[model samples]
Target: METKKNPNLEIGRNSSIYFAIGLNIMLFFTWRGLEYKSYEKDDFAMEILDIGEEIEEDIPITNLEAPPPPPPPPAAAAPDVITIVEDTEEIEETVIESSETDQDDEIADPIEVSDVAVEEVEEEVSVPFSVVENVPIFPGCKGKNNTELRNCFALKMNEHIKKHFKYPESALEMGVHGKVFVLFAVDANGNVSNIKTRGPDKKLEEEAYRIISLLPTMEPGKQRGRPVKVPYSIPIHFKIQN
Candidate 1:
């Protein structure tokens, strides 16, 4: 016996069309269930309360009488006459004269004024190395012009540093190597006044200060043809060679 195949059993042939139709039908039913609904508004009536009018009453006034005035004062009596008698005895009075005329005639002694010598105050001003007209002359840097003198001054300073460069033995033993900044001022009198030093170690600072203090007295810098203080700063480096 031979059996015939059902058309619905052949799903592979029309499965896509059937699936699309079923999905569309489900979507339509879902949209209809979720439709928006609007409510109807109810009408309301407003009521107002009535207010009564205010009433006023009139007040009455009474008349009063005033009292009478007081009586006047009495008149004053007359004064009596007096008689005075003259004295016959003579009185001698001594008159005192003013001494202001004698004081005016007398002359005061002249005050002797002694001559006092006033000491002049010298103003000590600091001038920069670059802008100073007459820079502090380093030893052996004489006879050079202003610009040449400045350059020579710097060269001489560097040469002096190298000549006197000494590493502190304590600093070297401790493996301390750093730079020290030394500041010194050449005063108006060509003498080094203030010397300051800063370094990483006390030994290094002391070495720097000693080197600076050894600097010979230089020719004082001049500004406006007058001697002034010149401040100079130099950095010294200390390093240990391998």
Candidate 2:
């Protein structure tokens, strides 16, 4: 005993299996078509690669040439100079003989004959004494007209003092500062002459002389409008204070 099969059930099962197979085939073909389209769009880039490969094959290689060498430096010039040798000659000096001339004979001949006359000459003069009284001393005038004379005299004296002496700092420390009196003559030509120190010290006397020497000649002193030779006197004082 064999039983009969179910035809309707078997047919239904076959229809479901066929539907699943059709869906899988549709999905596989859709993926393959998208991939092929993408490759087709980028085909130009592949042609560029082919062109680069052909260019590389056609290019030829070559050796490069080097640059030219630099020029040489200029030579230095020699210096200009000269050398010389000096030649010297010797000279001899000669001495001459001495003899008496006419001038010497005149001086010596007279003296040799005057021996007796020389014996009679005296050593000193003997003369009678004459008394002098009331000698007139011409003192300078004291007035505005005498100002130039006074200034000139002072200037000379100042110069002389400056030359011969320095300010006495040591003496000043010892309280030994005082005045020295001096007398000098003014001649007709307004020149100072015959200086004298009336009251003296070794230092003071020398200083007085120096000052008098420096003094300029004054306009001669005048008495009643007549110019007269006069004597001028000045006192110089040196003093220091603490």
TM-score of each: 0.52, 0.30
Once model 2 is optimally superposed onto the true structure by TM-score, how far is the C-alpha of residue 140 displaced, in angstroms? Answer: 17
lDDT of each: 0.85, 0.56
Residue 164: error of model 2 in Å? Answer: 8.4
Worst 10 residues of 1 by lDDT: 37-46
Per-model root-mean-square deviation over C-alphas? 16.0, 30.2
Off by over 4 Å in 1: 1-116
For this target, which candidate reaches the highest TM-score against the unseen true structure? 1
User: What digit string (tens of lDDT, one per residue) describes model 1 on residues 14-118?
Assistant: 879999999999999899878956655554455687787866666677666666666666667666766677898899999998766654486777755555566
Instruction: Kindly report which residue stretches of model 2 are placed more than 4 angstroms away from their true locations once superposed.
Output: 1-165, 168-176, 224-226
TM-score of 2: 0.30
lDDT of 2 at 47: 42
Task: Give the Cα error of residue 122 in candidate 2, in Å.
Answer: 32
